[model samples]
Target: MYQYKNNILSIPARLLYQDWSLMSYDTYKKKCDRKQLIRTQQGKGLGNEAFLSYADLPHEIKSVCLDKIGRPEETVVINLLEPFIIPDSKASAFFSNHRTPEGRPLAEPKQRQKSINCWILNAVQLVFEDRGMTGKMFGKRKTRIWQNISEAVNKLDTNKWNHTLPGAAKRLKEKYENYLKEGYGIFIHKGEGNQNTAKIRGEVADFILSHYALPIKLTIPMVLAKYNLRRLEQNWPELAESGLYHWLYEPEQERIWTLARHGKQAWQNKFQHTLSRDKSNWFPNVYWAIDGTKLDWIHFDHTTGHKMASKLRINVLFDVYSEKIIGWSLSETEDHTDHFKAIKMAVKQAECRPYLLTYDNQSGHKMTRMQEFYNDLVALKGGCHHAHRAGAKNNPAEQLFNRFQQQVITKFWFSDGQGIRVKKEDHQPNTDFITAHKHHLKSKEELSPAWEMAVNQWNSGKHPHFEESRDEMYQHPMSLREQLSLQEIMQHLWVTESQKPITYKKEGLTLWLSHTQYQYEVYDGDGNIDIEFRRKYVGKKFIVRYDPDAMDVYIQLCELNAHQEKVFVAFAEPKRKHIDIPVLMQADDKMSWARDYAVRDIEYKRDKTAFEALIARSGYSPSAFIESQELNIKFKGSMPKKQQQKVDAEEDEVLLRM
Candidate 1:
């Protein structure tokens, strides 16, 4: 059926015509083999015998050969497409002799056997197809043919295949016949060696999951104990603790287990999918996040004359866009006062009010006073304020506070580890050492400066989204100014001394606030007592609002609107005291005194002029009445008593008419 010359196997024309129906080998070779359609081998002693490398033949031609020889095309295609290399024939021996550097077999025992089986199947198929032998050719003849094909496969591609084929002739024959009958499935091991023995029954698995996945956080051991008590009654098989653990802690069940055992809040904080907010377009003063956190450092308390029992609270107003600490205050307690100071500082420094303020529902923030300011500021800017639910995990201000604690407080030796959620086992401060060196503890005074330094350092740090530092980003000029005058902002921030209406007096609007007396009088923009304002508004009632720090400057006067809300009227300055001595008088004082004197002199002159005009309007003369009286006296001296009496009577009548 075939011939070999110079070790190149070739198919004879008669066999090709018998198997493939190629009428002329020369014509076929010229049209197909020469064109590389069928791989051809040149043999030195070839004549009428077509030199061919069976392994290198075209797949179609190999399929025809396999069909003629009664072998499946699948196995033939696999063998022809990736024919056995030279190393394959001795693969079993090479694998058995070779060992890893550690002196272990190159492949796992089972895997090695699988590779050998695969090779045995390929080699037997190659022998039948290449040697044109079949199972019908039995005993030594078939064995001899197998030996020849295996030797050739080993001599060809020595570097390509790294496998072993080791089996008796009988075993090889059995595998080959089985492979042809049942295809590739025969190689797949169906033994109990690789079976999953630890898999629990479906009902048992459901019971384990139902008990293990719960909010009470039962450990595997605890869950196992509970299952043990119940499994005996339910006729369940004994379970290994390790297997139970593996089943319960599978990666696929992690989310379900966490949610069930840790509760919704914990799951949300730790595992919920969250999206990042894009704040690239946000500008400073457009959004402000305010929150307070304890400083986590023990400091000396001057008021108590000893080391503080608690940490100081730090209230901060953070510009969300820039992440800048725009304003902050250190206090023994967090209250509306601290919030007021912080917000006031922020507004003052930014020269603008925030368009939106984000805060949590804390006692300090919920004060009617603070809430009103928040509402009024947003109202003025046509923006809105939002109050986050208390203890929310996603508050931006809380994240900022966390960063502050980590980046700032952790730098100090006295800082408490409580500020950080995750800390080294040995990170906590030594209380005994702190107590022994109590004098070294920082006082509120020292901490104040230190806190200020930390704030400056934070503001100087690089911003997350911008190339500049936090302060630089915040200080960058805004495209559109939301600038509010300091006074205007103060109107909202200042506390109301008394909501009850009080009448304005000459001495100004007087009220008792925080155990101190404050007197405010109407003053014009030029710092002069506004006499016209005083005349118009004096004795009228109004509500007073004053800045505690600026009590000497002015107070805001407001009147009740139809809605019973205080509507700002005007600014009333602290009442000015007159300078008794001229030498101590300022220019303004002298001017005020001169205006008062001038007004008095003008009033006196006007009153005298008004008297003369009144006499003329009466249509009577005082000189005429005096002349008549003198004439009557003369007549009494020269004439009779009756004539004198008549003259006196006529004079009296004229006087009465006047």
Candidate 2:
């Protein structure tokens, strides 16, 4: 009693092997053909041996097989006769009648599937249709669709089709939405009303639809809608209180929040330590670097005169170790004397002798007096040397000046607190108003000193790199303490040597000293000398031991004749101070500063013959002689206006000449 169920064929009962007997006969015949057998045997055998018919084989293989065999029809027949034996039933089922319980037919058996380009086109058409669009619409209206398809095909060829498909779909959607949005022209408009209060929300839905590539959860319309709802409730309160909207719009607020969060994190990570201790060798000796900078005086008392408007030069010396200002001096002039005074003050204040004192190669530094001072210290064995060749980068002292200008000077405004009372402007009609406000603005005074004090306070308060205040760090006790007084220490640190004179030979009346020749003669009672008796390079000035009773001016000269020439000898004027020439010469040996090293006998008061002999032997140019005199005087105190003007003019002339 077999019952049929809706024309369904049951597996096994329906006899899927109906053609088995015929297939076996055909397989037996095929097995006899060697060509067909070899063809079936090719490739790795998974299990089943399903043969490809010669007629069904690709054209490429058929052509190659025919060429190899040398006869097209025979080769085809031989290849067709080859039989491929099926494996065990279970293995055969893999390529044959494998089916599930649903009893649907398995895939087409052992026949290579033909590639259908039309079928691919159909699948593409179906895809477009599913999106409520057509291929024509995609290609004609949106050119990117065709581009995307080409790109997808390239991806498919490269085996990267899996990733490209989804991305391409997303990009296409975004492009289409953007096109429509731009067509409608929806944008955020700013400053539309009085105090920017009028708000118009128009075509927002269309905008969202056009810009649909944006994440639905992050859509601008959704955000704005919520914002507007909130604004409605707060509008009255905002208008009543201070009349300003405090809430910042989207992107700007987000940026500010992000920066603040990151900034706080960075600040928390910062740490401080003692820079001096971190690098011990950085400050081994007390190297005080000295320099001066001019700071402008903005507020000047007009009554002090226009000269008061001149800038002040502030000299400062910094101890390189503690970064403390060891010395400071303020002067109205930028001269060598002012610089020396500053240096003296700084030395007196520090009390600790700096092993090295460095300053720029300014005229003041190269002056004879200053150089003499350095030489004197060197003579005393001080390890002192001028940092003559330091460039801006090598000198940290100059950096401090830069810091002062940048940090302090540039930040303040100057003002004088003094008030003034003056007559008001006379007006024939508005007398009452004019009389009511009769006071005048007061004159201004310099506020730089106060500003400087403020800077000192600031520097002492906290250091940028160091954990402690500058004062605290400087005052902190250390293992090493300086043992020598500042001056003595400077002397100990310097290298010194005696200068040897360059001499020249002359026959007649002059003796050569330092390349210059001077006539040697004993002054008569009237401080006069016989020009004919003058001794030249005679070594005649040598002291001779004589009996005290027989002491007399010894004259040694080659006298060819008794005729005498009266030499007008200039004696030290009784009222004038007598400068011991020898003492002055010895003073040159230990110069406190090079500025005071005098070149002797520049302007001779003796006879022209003596002067000419001195000039010729010394090789002293008149210009150099004049320069030496001009350089020797130390100008101190404030000069009168006329004198200062003259000095300034002279300085300009000198600079121009240079």
Indicate which candidate wins on lDDT: 1
Per-candidate RMSD, Å: 43.7, 46.2
Model 1, C-alpha of 106: deviation from truth (Å): 99
lDDT of 2: 0.38
Off by over 4 Å in 2: 1-285, 299-308, 375-382, 388-391, 415-455, 478-658
Q: Please give the lDDT score for candidate 1.
A: 0.62
Query: Which lDDT tens digits does candidate 2 get at residues 1-658?
Result: 1111111111121111132232354554464354432232222378633333444344554564455434433221111101111123333333245322223333542211111112222334455655443432233346456554434333332221121222355444553345345421111112211232222122222121222212222344443443344354445211211111212122222222222223323212221000101132334745678787765333344556632242456777776767777666665555555555555555555555556777887776666546755554321345575855745567777887766554555444331111123243220123343234323312233354565575586558566678988777777664443444765744332211112211111121233322432333333464433222222221222211111111132222222122343222222111111223343434633442222122111111232233334333433323443453364354553667787656543542342243
In model 1, where is the ten-residue run with the lowest total lDDT? 72-81
> Can you write out model 1's per-residue Cα lDDT over 1-658, one digit (the tens) per residue?
4444323444543455455674465665675545653434443374634455555556787677666654432231112323332224444555466533224454556446545556646655654574333432221364365554444434333334444443344444566678679754465434222122255546576555544654456687776675676566668776656667655554334434554556556544433322222233344538899998888887777778685545688899999989998888787777776787888888888877677898888877876667777887653646778889756786889998877877777677667655345476455666676678778888777888888888999999998777899988887776555667867876677876444678775346787754567666676777655655553465577877766557787788888775668799998876655554666666986776665435323422433343334334432234544566577676657878788667644542454366
**Residue 268, model 1: Cα distance from true site in angstroms:** 68
TM-score of 1: 0.39
TM-scores for candidates 1 onward, in order: 0.39, 0.27
